[model samples]
Target chain A: MSDIVFTNVARNFRRDGKEFPALRDINLSVRDKEFLAIVGPSGCGKTTCLRMAAGLEFPTSGTVAVGGVRVTRPGPDRAVVFQQFALFPWKTVAENIGFGLVANGVAAAERARRVADVLKLMNLAGYESAFPHQLSGGMQQRVAIARAYVLDPQVLLMDEPFGALDAQTRVVMQEELVRLARVNPRTVLFITHAVEEAVYLADRVVVMSRRPGTIREIIDVASVRAADSWDRFEKIEDVMDQASFVHLRTHIWRLLREQQAPDDH
Target chain B: MSRRTVVGIATLLAVAGLWYLLTAATGWVGSARFPNPAEFGTAVKQIVTGGYAGARIHEHVLQSCKLVAMGFLVAVSVGLPLGLLMGWNRRAEALINPVFLIIRPIPPLAWIPLAIVWLGLGDGAKIMVIFFAAFVPSVINTHAGIRNIEPFLIEAARMLGVRGPRFVFGVLLPAAAPLIFTGLRLSLQASWTTLVAAELVGALLGLGYVLNAAAQDIFPAMILTGMVFVALSGAASTWLLGRLEQRVTRWRTA
Candidate 1:
């Protein structure tokens, strides 16, 4: 069975007595351990798609199943990293990472161990006591990532997780996400507006059409795993400069650009 | 000290100098209604050392503080949870809000006659009035605080498998805290404003009681003394509230 599946999903939201459809006739499947990115314009239900699988949103008419079981509500099996980082302002970095584990009734020692592991892995070793506001935007997003990663859920759902960061930070976060997937492979249903972001991190990029969004195309990119080295950042940055990376990015950009223009008479 | 502190002290001195000049020096304003600065100073010394209305000045101040603390605490204990419920659950809001709206617009001082009839001329009536004053603002602001929580925060919490009470206390409350504290501060101010008004009905020991008696006797010095006490206490409470708010919401600062 696929890690996640959306079978004929449609979502409708009502506003002022009008039933506005956000997504329609959506059918997709994410293979186990696959990193799938959905790239689309704003208001195109890319987020709606990710939220449906996360069980934060329910499809109006279709089934969202994970591991062959239908999703009825949010469960520990799937974890989400939101765009705003949404780290609890009152909580220190360690507390935010340990939140889910504590809720799950993990023993204190084990929770601390897991939290320490994620913080170290995310390169946030000594800053565990700092609050979210005390950290930079990039560091805050790293805490958010560690928050999700510590859960070790079956699937990670990211909704424009780095969209708020500056360009340089966004690139670094993307590389961090790639390294995370390499070390501990899991299904990731990633959504982004940046074509390069989608192409860089995804195993297969799912191009979504405009409103009442459905899958337009799914392009498979060559996978580049993190090399076992201290200089992982340089190796990943070099992946972006490859000819295939440029070619694929241009192709996705053209597809998105073409969809934005009005159809010819 | 800070520049702001220097400016504040300067402003106070300037205002006092103007009042002294007008009433004591120029005699442009009569000292009957507005006591001269020297007489006011003597009254303060007399009240602090000698006594006012057969009770020490501190006794009256302490009594008023007790009334406000009791009423404000009761209002918060009841209103905080009630408001949180109203904000969280639609049915609770529908059931409770209409009556709250109708009664809220009627000022707490307006409740004096009815409170006297119901609870009699005692501490009960005074506290009831202060409670009403504090309760309305507390409930309204707490409800608003909960309602104003960012939708993204709720979404993020739910996505992390947080729900029910954990979500309410853990996610909702902290997110709504800045506004909740704002509600508390407003409620506290309301409690103080209505304290003297509450003490008007047959009370004989509070600052309000002393001031009322002094007003009948046309003792401007006593009135000014009472005003000074009220001003000082109000400033103290506000400063305390500010410190509390700052400490609780330190996370808001970068």
Candidate 2:
């Protein structure tokens, strides 16, 4: 069964007495265990699409399905990792990770075990009792990832998960997420504005047009791999050289610029 | 000793020295109104031994504390849940907000006559006055605390399978606790002030009653003693609440 399917989805928002369309006629299917990234300009509704899939927002029209079931609301089956590292300030690192388990009424012992496992995986084993404020930005994001992972969701929805991090930390988190996806092959719908992040993590990158967002192109990066001696930067440059990747980026850049241009005529 | 203790002692000595100089100077204006430190000390000893009033100093202190405690308990029991409801539901806000706005403007002491009419001149009337004084701040602050939570945090929690009462208890309450504690502290102080005002009417006990009696006899030292007791009780209660706040917000400090 397909992990997630969005059929001609549309979303509109009413602001200041005007209705603005965000996403329109979007159709996509993410296969089971596939890592898909949606990349677009600032106002292109890439985050909106991920939010819909995570059940934080309902589509204005059309349907979104996960694991062959129509997603009516958020559930344990699709855990979301937000961009801002939304760890509960009052909860310790361990407690935050175990929040979903606790809410689902899992036994205390089982919850503790799962939290411990994920903490170790996220390299946050020794920081279980620390609060979010006490942790560094990168560490807090690790906690966010651990929280999502501990849920063992069939699909992971990430919205610019490392966008707030410094360059070095962002690259580190990207590699960690890659290693994580390798070990636990869950379908992921990742959203980012960064082209390098899209190329590095996604099995396929779905490029979106500017506001009233529509899919411009989808570039499959499954076969683009680094040679044995090539470093990560070289691998990224190679991926950027692919004609499909270059075309998609330039095409998206033009579309965004047009969206920003004044309507003089 | 700690710096706070050292500074406190130094301040006390300075005040005592000033009092002695003022009383020693006969031509000094309003010298009789402010007694010397020695006279104040003697008066405190007499009050402790039931020299100034029929009742000992401890009796008044205990009475005031009992009233404050009862009033604070009532305020918390009513205010916390109401605040949570208002914060959680927009409908509750629409319905209850007008009533709160109407009631909040009326001073706590204004309720004294109604409380007396309803409950008679007793502890019941005193506590009711105090409760009215404390309730408004507690509810308003608690509602603000809940409303001010980051929207993204709530969205994140919802997307993690949290909903209904579980969501409120697990995420919302913990997040809003520091702000709520602030409200509680303010309410407690307000309750103490209300208790004193209530006692001024017809109370036979409490620091307020003692202060009134001392004022009638023009005994500045006894009046000062009463004032000191009131200040001490307020400070102690506030310090206790501060400790509680620290415990609840320890996670943020981590």
Leading candidate by DockQ = 2
Q: Over all chains combined, what TM-score does candidate 2 have? A: 0.93
Best by TM-score: 1
Q: How does residue A50 of candidate 2 score in lDDT? A: 87
**Model 1: CA > 4 A from native:** A223-237, A261-265
Local distance difference test, each candidate: 0.87, 0.85
**Local accuracy of candidate 2 as per-residue lDDT tens digits, B1-254:** 99999999999999777767767555373636876667788889998885455588889888899999999989988998899889989999999999999999999999999999999999999999999988988898889989999988898788777888888877888878988898899899899888888998888988889888988889888888899999999999899888988897877665
Report how far residue A256 has shifted in candidate 1, in Å: 1.9
| All candidates: interface RMSD | 1.7, 1.3
RMSD of every prediction: 2.8, 2.9
Alpha-carbon deviation at B162 in model 2, angstroms:
3.0
Question: Against the true two-chain complex, what DockQ does each candidate achieve?
Answer: 0.59, 0.74
> Which portions of model 2 show Cα errors greater than 4 Å?
A226-265, B1-9, B25-31
